[model samples]
Target: MTAVVNVFLKEGVLDPQGKAAHHALDSLGFAGVSDVRIGKQIIINLETEDRATAEAEVKEMCETLLANTVIEDYTIEIN
Candidate 1:
């Protein structure tokens, strides 16, 4: 099985890296963009083929280490 995790900041959180990217884009004449947010994707391979088990394991991984629960949220995809 394969698990895909997307971790991103929650709403109302500050994103300095995103801000820098937005500023750079504007400087490069991409003024149409009003905002930007940065996040991370994690792909993991698992021995179990069951989707439910994979999802549960990945969710635990996210809660324990993959994502900062206080400021970040994550979605898990199993395949």
Candidate 2:
């Protein structure tokens, strides 16, 4: 099974890195680039054959180590 985890800052949280990237784009003369947000993505491939089991394990991984719930949110997809 293949698992994809997407982690991103919660709404209303300031993302300085994203802002910097946006500024850089503007400086490069990319017009109409109004905003940018940065986030983290993790991909994992496992040997599990069960979809439900893989989802559960990936959720646990996100809650335990992949994301900071206080400032970020995460979602998982298994394929």
Candidate 3:
């Protein structure tokens, strides 16, 4: 099984890199662009055949290390 984790800053938080990218886009004459937010993707392949255990482990991994819970949010997808 494969687990995919997507980590992103929560709403109301400031993302400097995203801001810079947005600014650059505006400067490049992309007027339709409004906002840009940055996030990260992590892919993990598990050896376990049990879907329940794999999901539990992946959630634990996200909570423990993959994401900053205070300022960041995450979503999980299992395949």
Candidate 4:
């Protein structure tokens, strides 16, 4: 099974990296980019074939190690 996790900052959180990227884009003349939010993607290969089990395990991984839940949110996809 393959699990993919996308982790990103919460809406109200200030993202310094995102801000920097936005500024850079503006300087480079990439106009009309109103905003940018940075995030991370993690891909994991699991031995289990069950999609339910993979999702559950990946969710746990996100909660325990992959994300700081207080400031970030995550979505999980299993295949």
TM-score of each candidate structure, all chains considered together: 0.95, 0.96, 0.94, 0.96
User: What C-alpha lDDT do the candidate models reach, one value each?
Assistant: 0.93, 0.94, 0.96, 0.93
* TM-score of candidate 2 against the unseen true structure: 0.96
The better candidate by lDDT, 1 or 2, is 2
Residue 23 CA displacement from its true place in model 1, Å = 0.1
Overall local distance difference test of candidate 2: 0.94
The residue-by-residue lDDT of candidate 4 on 1-79, one tens digit each, is 8888999999989999999999999999999999999999999999999888888888889999999999999999887
Most accurate candidate by lDDT:
3
Estimate, for each residue in 16-74, the C-alpha lDDT of model 2 and write its tens digit.
99999999999999979878999999999989999999999999999999999999999
Sorted on TM-score, best first, the list reads 4, 2, 1, 3
How does residue 26 of candidate 2 score in lDDT? 91
Off by over 4 Å in 3: none
Query: What are the per-residue Cα lDDT tens digits for candidate 3 across 13-79?
Result: 9999899999999999999997999999999999998999999999999999999999999999999
Clashes of 2: 0
Report RMSD for candidate 2: 0.7
